[model samples]
Target: MTRKLTPKEAAQRYLREREPDVARATLYNHRSLLKQWWQWCESQDIEYVNDIDGFDLAYFRLDRQMEVGEVTLYNQMTVLRVFTRWLQSRGLVANGLADGMVVAQPDDASRNTKIDSITAQQILSYLEKYEYPSLRHVVFAFLWHTGMRLGALRAIDLKDFHPKEHYVELHHRPETGTPLKNKEYSEREVNLALWCCSILDDYIEGRRHDVTDNYDRTPLFTTEQGRVSHSNVRDHINQITRPCDYTRECPHDREITNCEATTRLHAARCPSSIAPHDLRRSSVTYLLDEGHRKELVADRVDLSVRTMEEHYDKRSEAEKRKLRRDEFGMDG
Candidate 1:
């Protein structure tokens, strides 16, 4: 008979013995899921480690599928599979419960669906009509134009911007708390467009008033309280797009009308339907449309050619029509 270890004990041991190089955030997420698994086992009156088999794993995954999206359920299954293998290696469990786990794959039709890309004209319109403080406006403008991922944007410090060199060096300094998803060697320099530099110049000038001390280490983007986080940037974007109430005269001319007006006037006015990542996609699309080589664009944007083609190479209906017309000489 195989020795039995309690779920809690196994989890604690696994965590203590796991790879030290694993990110703290990733470990925390695993711990959270394991705790939930243990809690479910207790509630079900099941022997957590000893009784869990392929069937039990399948049922747990089915329960997760009912509550979560396909992608999340798949991720959960992956985590559980890794944990079960670890448990088996440690001799805490007789069976690897993940042997027969089934995870639903995302639909092919849904996988290729694309988000609306921000256009240069739309971005210009947004900037012209936005009424936010200068720094916020600058960040919005920069994101729309450069299509930098939020992670890279947040990692930028004042020294990262080199106006004289016409490029920004994205250094690998995880020790400074700016973690890159792709690790150190993946860090590369990005050439700043003239427009992007002009926006930065305006932002820096506006930011000087808010800085009492000459701290060059200060982040390129700051919050109202002079500190910023990834979530704070998301919140700012959300706050910028919220609808406002405006009163208008009733067409009947009998009474005044109060209507909630939601305008997509600028970056602040962009439809809340779009996300930050979509801006990067839009940039890639624009670059491709302008005849930039796929490999060159991918290198500049820090993406693989496969990723660029798979996600950002979407063409709009109008563009598609134009392409056909051009090829067939419809205008002749």
Candidate 2:
């Protein structure tokens, strides 16, 4: 005999059935989306599992069309579809609510817009001129040089870095709280450049001096007290860029309108306008410029070759200009 189950019960069962390897954060995200779906159904006076038809799902998609972007709507639809399918499998619902639902495709133009990559010289100038807490500066330097994703960087422990070996082992096991972006076997060891090794050594030493308790088990990047949240890193980037003068002028001192000053201003202004993911793109670009093969670079950085080509293949305006000048044999 088939038994009736409420939306909440079905959601709980679905979550319990999810892959054990899924990260806690990912599970929490799915739960949050399900809660939103439940709230919508409750407000509409609909018996969520029984009353939500394909038409209701369609209406919800249309309602959220403008409020949410295409990618987000797609993910939400995916989550709801999974929930409805679970209900159907358990004989709780007659039909899956999302079986016939359609999600809008992402606009090609919007998806194709290139992300700006920070140059090595620009990053160096920012480090030299900008004043940040030593730990934060080191964190920025490591990310710019190493190409580690923001999540992986935040989740890294003290033992992740090997100064003598000059390599970082990205452990993607369940216990480490590191989520693999794709398949389970994607985790691998990545070699660090000498420059990144030196910066990491300094940062680790500085962190030792800064923290007094549980230093052995603490995160690599942290605030004065201990490990910092991702939000803290975002806020720090905003704070650093708030006073930047992006018109190629030095806001601190107008007379200093040289290459060094302009570069610093650009770096300072970038974080507010750009996402942290751009740092990874910049690092990939650097690797490519240094004669690294695409496949090797992708494997080292835990990214696919297609992803490297699609996102990190951007050439800066400065690089383009230099190329043009060299081709034309023009004197500057």
Candidate 3:
């Protein structure tokens, strides 16, 4: 007979067991996503994992669906499904409980939101002219050019970069606190363009903080304290991606000086500002639209081609048709 486990106990155990196997960010997200379910369990007075059934899972999904968007609900359900399956493996929950949970399907509009090439170029041009070699410039440029996930970008060390070879090797080093999303599978060499390499070199030589993290690893991106936190990287992206910040023209027709989003803390509130993931999606779509092969772009960005096509490819039908026509010389 299996021992009884409270919902909280099961969640803590699952997260603890998963910590070593996943990246710090991934583990943290899992914890956060599951925390809601655990809280719901407590509210419903469902004390033990054994008490969770198919109806309970359905009700929880309904409750959360009312509170979040389809994409967020999907993510929550996916994580909860995994948690349910894990509990079943431990004999804490009934078998097939996970099978009963339905993951939400996001609409095309939700999946298709991304920065376009023109806007991306504008941001890059502004950075190149004014903020070249600065932390904001380096981070934004690296994300746009490489399309690597923020976690992977943050995990770079001074030693991992090779200005001479024009590539950086990504390693899975969870013991040292920076693990890739796919762990060992995600480790690969990302090549840099000459322009990107030049900017990175300037930053390292002139502006980079040159500080070692707590693990004694010298991060390519850092502050006086150590390795930059994920939130800090996200904030930098938000701040720089604001249209007014680079363009000095507010498309929203608001007075720039009086706009709340002009402040560093509230930059994300800007209607035109985008998140780091938007940069990644934009980069992937830009590479594909530029005629790069799906497999090659997939390798560069560390994403499966299917995921790229389904989620990241925001190119319009007309644009895709034009590419095909140009490829076949049908334009003549």
Candidate 4:
């Protein structure tokens, strides 16, 4: 008799089935949600993956809702519902089991999709003055100014820099390492502003540790052993943006002697600290606000016009109309 497949086994099969049609990033995200469910079931002593029902799924949904905000919960549930439907397709779960996992229908409300983008000027002014010559300062500057994805930044190499031209070449190298989100199509040379280039020059000459990752690729941003992982980059961005760093006052009012983020290596737990991707969104918006055409901004950011408007461009309707008026020669 064929052995019963575990949820872990099922998830892998589902991913393999979907990998051909979906983007690598999308596949990774789907696998992540399913992996969480598998781990949660294991924690609950669920020995048989095929045994979970809609009621169990509902409880899982509640647990997630309590742990995260509405936006996060909604995204997680949407992925969970997809996994449930996949299970149903395989005849491993009852029909319509995915319905129980649905918590709220996603709408066009701004809050439901993304948070407000923090402007480049706001973040850069703080990072430039307070955290200068630091990795956080460098990372923040690159993310905010380039409008590049975290993964693309993570993939940068030491040789990719052309200091004379104030630009760096981005390559998609999935076979060896450092895969760009859009693969080969994402490869291009991005020019930096004069000041930004100077900052990167100082960082390379002083701070960045010279090392090669396991793939034998020499990364521009390296820690002691090799290239810094994705989590490290995210942690650096999170810690530097803590309210205490910029304001000189701890918003949480915790004692300096007792706080977790007081040290250089630790990230702040401050609720307001935004992630690396938020910086990308902010870059797109800031450029648009400066009267840069939407198409130009989209091309510079390596995103399609529709994707930028639907996702990256965070301008309000009034703000958008104001931007268009300059081209139309209309009164403000």
Which candidate has the top score in lDDT?
A: 3
User: Candidate 1 clashing pairs?
Assistant: 126-266
RMSD of 4: 4.2
> For every model shown, what is its TM-score relative to the native structure?
0.57, 0.59, 0.73, 0.81
Candidate 3 lDDT, 1-332, residue by residue in tens: 87888888889999999987876777877898888888999999998888889999999999986655455567778888999999989888788888877786766342324678898889989998998888999999999999999999989999999999999999999889898988899999999999999999999999999789999999999888999878788789888888898899988888999988788877766766667888899899999899889999999998888988899888899999999888888954
- Deviation from native of the Cα of residue 264 in model 3, angstroms: 1.4
Look at candidate 1 and tell me the lDDT of residue 146.
Answer: 67
- Provide the overall lDDT of each model, using Cα atoms, as 2-decimal numbers: 0.62, 0.61, 0.86, 0.76
Give Cα distance to truth, residue 1, candidate 4, Å. 9.0
Model 2 ranges with Cα > 4 A deviation: 20-32, 39-48, 54-70, 89-96, 111-114, 118-144, 149-151, 162-167, 179-189, 193-216, 223-286, 303-332
Return the clash pairs for model 3, or none.
none
After superposition on all CA atoms, what RMSD does each candidate show versus the true structure?
Answer: 8.3, 8.4, 5.3, 4.2
Q: Residue-wise lDDT of candidate 2 within 145-166, one digit each (tens)?
A: 6777766666566777788998
Best by TM-score: 4
| TM-score (C-alpha, index-matched) for candidate 1 | 0.57
Model 1 root-mean-square deviation: 8.3
Where's the lowest-lDDT run of ten residues in candidate 2?
264-273
**lDDT tens digits by residue: candidate 4, 290-332:** 8888888887779999998898877899887877897689995
Specify the poorest-scoring 10-residue window by lDDT in model 4.
106-115
Clash pairs, candidate 4, are none
lDDT of 3: 0.86
